[model samples]
Target: MKTREYTFFGGIHPRSYKELSNKYPIEEYLPKSQVIIPLQQHIGAPCTPLVKVNDYVKVGQKIGEANGFVSAPVHSSVSGKVVAIEDRPSSSGKLVKSIVIESDGEFNYDDNIKPNEDINNLKPEEIRYIVREAGIVGMGGATFPTMVKLNPPSDKKIDIVILNGAECEPYLTADHRLMLEKPVDIVHGLLAIMKALGASKGYVGIEDNKQDAIKEIRKACKEYEGVEVAVLKTKYPQGSEKHIIKAITGREVPSGKIPAEIGVVVDNVGTAFAIAEAIKYGKPLIERVVTVTGEGIMTPKNLRVKIGTPFRELIEYCGGFKGTPGKVISGGPMMGIAQYSIDVPVIKGTSGILVLPEDMIALKNPKPCIKCARCVDACPMNLLPLFISAYSLKNDFDKCKEYHAVDCIECGSCSYVCPSKRPLVESIRLAKGEILRKGRK
Candidate 1:
C-alpha cells in the first residue's frame, strides 16, 4: 500500500526510548495480594460503590456503578472479598475512594460474561449499550467514556472514525505492541465503533517509526472497505486526538470544542481492542497493556496488567529498580503525571509506569525569557506560551485568558523548545485551571 506521510503544524521529535520495551512481548500479570479499584477513573463524576467492605466480588463483577451519564463503571479485577472501601492515593496525586479486594487466585469470571450477538446483527443502540456496559473508555490517557462519544447530538454528523495507533509519547510502546499483536481485533473494534456512530469511513493513524505495526494494521484492513492505515510523521504529541484528526483528515477542531463538533471521533488502539473483546466475549475493562520501562528500571517490559494493581508490584515484577528512582510517572514523560507514592493503584487512565534514575532527574531554576520566539514557533496550538506564562506568573489570569491560554493543548512543545528552560506548560496549565474555575463560578 502506497501511503503519504501526514503531520500537524508544529510538534517536537523527542528521543523515543520505545526500543527498551517495544521489543518485549506482553506478559500477563495477576495481582499478587490485592487490587485497589478506584471509584472515579473517567473524566466525569465519580461512580458510587455498589459493593461494600467484606462483600464477595468476582472478576468482571461491577463494584462501582457509574453515578452519571458521563462516567464509566468499575469492575473487580480479581475474585476475592472486598477488604475495604476507603480513600487511597491515585495516579493524579489526589486521594480517591477505592475498593480494595484480596485475591482468591481462582480468577473466576462473572456469569454475565458471555458472547454477545454477532456484529452484523447488532444494532447501533445495541452496540452503544455493550460499550457502556463494558465500561470502555478512551484508553489513550484521556479516559473519557466511550459511550458518550458514540452518542452524539443529532445535529452533528459524524463521518470519520480514527484509531490512534501513533504511540508518539517518549518511552511508551503499549499501543504499538497492541497494533502489531492484535491488528485484526483493533480493526474489528473500529468497525463496531463506526457502526455505532453511523460513520462510513475509518482510519488507523500510526507513526512512520513503527513500520511493523503499520504493515500489520494495513494487512488487517485489506478485507474491510473504508478502513485504511494512515502513516503519520513521527513526532511528540502526534498521538493526541486533535492532532491525529488533523493529520489524517486535514480537519481542524475548533478551539475549546470537541472533535465530534467537527464530524470526527478518535479512540485509542487499546480502547478499540477492549471494545472488540467486550462485543465478542463480554469482557469488561479490567486488564490493559502497560509499558513498564525507563533507565531506572532493571527489566523493562510491556505487560498486560489488571486495573487496580499497585505500581510497586509491577515494578518488582519487572525486576525492580536499577538504582534509586528519582521520579515515577504514570504515562509518558511529557504529558504524564508524576507520582509521589508507588503504592498508587493503576486506574483506567493509567497507560505506562515510567521510572527515571536520580542522575537523569535535573532540578533547575527557571530563567527569564529571552524573547527569542522559540516557544511561540514551537506551540502546536499557535498560542504565545511565553506571554501566557508571563501573565500567569504575575497572577494576571485575565491576561492569560485574553491570550487564549485555554486553547493550549499542554503538550509541552513550548517548554521543550524554550532556550531559557521556562515552565511554559506549567504556568499555562495553572492559568487554564483558574480561568475555568472562575468561569464555572
Candidate 2:
C-alpha cells in the first residue's frame, strides 16, 4: 500500500513533554513485596473471586472470573498467598474489591506455557476464546473488553481492523516502548486479532515522532499478507477511536455511533500484545507495561506491573519521588485522573503514573470566559464546549442536549486550548453524567 499523511478534525498542539522519559529503554520493574489486584480491571462487569484468603496461588492463576460477557477475568501477578479480597482504591479515584497478594520474592511462572503449534490451523472461534480468557482490553484507556470489540455485531460487517500505535498522549510512552521493544509480539497480536475478526485487510497507524515504532512494525509485517503500515501526523488525539479511523481510512463514524458502524474496529498496540500472548502461550492479561515518570519522580522507567499492584508501591519501586508531588495523575497529563492518593490499585487501563513536582504542576482557578473560542477550534469531536459548559452551569439539560454535550470525547483538547483557563471539559463531563442519568431514567 502507498504511504500518506492522513488526519482528522479539530485537535490541539499541546506541549509534547515526552522527552523527559523517552530516552530510556523499557526496564522490568522488580516485583514489590505485595500487589493488590482489582477484580474489575476492564469495562465489563466485576469478576467474582475464585480464591479465598490464605490460598496460595501462582503468578498466572486466575483469581477473579468475569461476571458476564462485558467483563474480563483478573489474574494474580505473583506467586504468593492471597492476603485479602476486599475494597481498595483503583486508579480512577474509586474503590473496588481487590485481591491483595503478598509476593514470595521468587517470581514464578506457570509451567504450562508453550508456543502455539500453528496459529493458522486454529479455528477462529478458538482464537476468540483465547483473547477473552486472556482478560485483554483496549489498553489505550478505553479498557473496553477486547473480545467484544473483535466480535462486533454480525450485521456490522466490518471491513477494516486498524492497529492504533499512536502514543498521542504526552508523558506516556508505554505503547511506544511496546512497539519498539516487542514488535514481533505486536505483529503476532495484530495477526491474532485479524484472525479473530476475520478481517482480510488491516492497517497499523503510528505517529511520525515514533518513527522507530513505525519502522519496527513495517519491518515485522513485511512478510504478513493483508496488513499495511501507515504513518500519521504527530498530534494529541490521534489515538482516539474516531480520529484514528479517519486518519487511516478517511472514514467518519457519524456522531452517536461506534467505529463498528463504519465498518471499522480500532485496537490498541498493547491490546494486540495481550492477544498475541493469549493466542500463542495461553497467557492472560493479568499485567502490563506501565510508564511511571514525571518531574516529581526520582527515576522515570517503564515497568511491567501486575494488574492489581498498588499505585504507591509502583511509585516506591521506582525509588520513590525525588520531590514532593503536587499532581499525581494515573494516565497522561491531558486525559489522566488527578489521583487523590497513592494507595490506589493500577488497572488494565493504567498506562502511566505521572507525579509532577509542586512547582511543575500548575493549576489555577477557572476564570470567566473571554469568548476566545480557542476551545471551539481544539475540540476533535467538533462540539461547542463553551456552549455545553454554559448550559451545564445553568442546569439547562435541554440546552446542553442541543449542544451535543453527550458527544464529547473528553480528549482534554478544549481545556488544553483555553487561554482563559476555563474548565470547559469538566463542566461538560457533569452534563454528560446528567444526560446519561436522565436517559436511563
Candidate 3:
C-alpha cells in the first residue's frame, strides 16, 4: 500500500467529528409513508416533470426529464402515486417545484433496469449516454451533471481522471463508508470513467485518516493497470476538485477555469460508485448513502437512503433529535447549506444531514477584522478574503471584482478561522453571486 501523503497549500484543520457516525456501518433506510423529490436537484437547468399528480410511478422510473444538455433527469425512488406536484421547500433553502409521492409499500422496480454490456467492451460515447440517462451528479455537494463533466469539449485533452475520496468536510462520512464497503465498485467506476474520457491514468485520492478505506481501495486496484491510490493529508477542503487535482496530479486549475482546462477530470468516489451501478445494472440514480450525524442526533449512522426521502424520516430513523437543535445543515458544517426546515428531501448532492446542538452553534456577532490575515493564510485558493469581504459588505462590487472575488471557492475557511467572528465567507459569497450576475449582463 502507498503511504505517501499528498496535499495542496492553505487549508484549515477543524475538529472532524466523524466518530459520531464513522464507526457505524451504513444501514438501509426505507421511507414507509412518502417521498418528496425536487426536479432541480442537479446544477444547471431544472428538469420538467413528466408525470402529473395521481400518476402511479414505479421505483427507478423516470418521472422528470432533463430540460437541457446541462441538466439531469429525476427518477422516482418508490412505487407510489404522486400526491402533489407543487413548490416545496428544498435543501438548497429554495422553494423548488417538487413531486410528492405516497408509497404503496410494494417497492416495485422498473422493468428497464438490468445489467448492460461489459465495461471493457463499451465505447466512450455509450458510457456518456448511460451516465446521462442515469441522472448521476457530483455527490460531493457540487451537483454538476456527471455526463457534462465526462463529455468535455474537444481540444481540451483530459489525461488523468481522479476519484475524490477525501471527504474532508467535518461530520460527513458517506464517502468514507462507501470506500470501505464498496471499494470494488469504486474501482470499477473509476475504470469506467477513464474509458469514457479515454484518459490514460486513473487515481483514487483518499485522505490518510481513512486507513481502512485506503487499504481496501488499494487492494481492489492492485490488478488494474494505470490505476493507483493516492493518499491525501487530512485537511479541510482537501476534497475540493481543484485542490484534489492539485494534490494528486500537481496541476493547478487556473482561476475562472475548470480541471478540464488543466488536462484533468475529477469525480467523487460516490459518483464513481453510481457510474458503476448505472453502467453495470442499468440503474438510474435513485438512491445514495448519506451520513446522518452530529451531537444533536440520538443515534448517528451512515444510511443507504432513497433520493426522495425526507430529512424528518432519516432523523427519526436515527432516533431523532436528542435536544433542542440549533441548526440543521444539508451537507457538512463547512460548506453545507443551513436548512430552514426538516421538510426538505435528500437530493443527489445531499452527502450528509448534520444537526448541530444549541451549544455547538456559533454566535453570528461581527467584530472588526484585526488585519490578522489568518483567512488569507487558510484559503486553499490563495486569495485575499479579507479585502474581498470588506468590499462586499460595503456593496462595492467593483472593488470586490478588482480583488478577484469570483475565485473564492466558498469553502468557509475564512469564516472558520476568523478570530473576530466576522462573516467573511458570507460577504464574499454575496460578492461572487453579484459579480457573476453582472458578468452575465
Best by lDDT: 3
- Candidate 1 pairs with clashing backbones: none
What C-alpha lDDT do the candidate models reach, one value each? Answer: 0.93, 0.85, 0.94
> How do the residues 1-441 of candidate 1 rate in per-residue lDDT, one tens digit apiece?
867999988788889999899999888999999999989999998999999889988889988998888999999999999999999999989999999999998999989889998789999999999999989999999999999999998999999999999989999999989998999999999999999999999999999999999999999999999999999999878988889998889999998899999999999999999999999999999999999999999999988999999999999999999999999999999999999999999887888999999999988578889999988877778889999999999999999999999998889999988878898999999999999999999
Give per-residue CA lDDT, model 2, range 314-380, as digits (tens).
8887789887789899999988999998988778999999998999865767888988888888888
Q: Which runs in model 3 stand beyond 4 Å of their true positions?
A: none
Candidate number that wins on lDDT, 1 or 3: 3
| Candidate 2: worst-modelled 10 consecutive residues by lDDT | 110-119
Candidate 3 residue 166 Cα shift, in angstroms, is 0.3
lDDT of residue 355 for candidate 3: 95
**What TM-score should be assigned to candidate 3?**
0.99
| TM-score between model 1 and native | 0.99
Question: Clash totals for all models, in order?
Answer: 0, 3, 0
Q: Residue by residue across 139-207, what tens digits does model 3's lDDT show? A: 988989999999888989898999999999999999999999999999999999999999999999999
Q: What order do candidates take by TM-score, descending?
A: 1, 3, 2
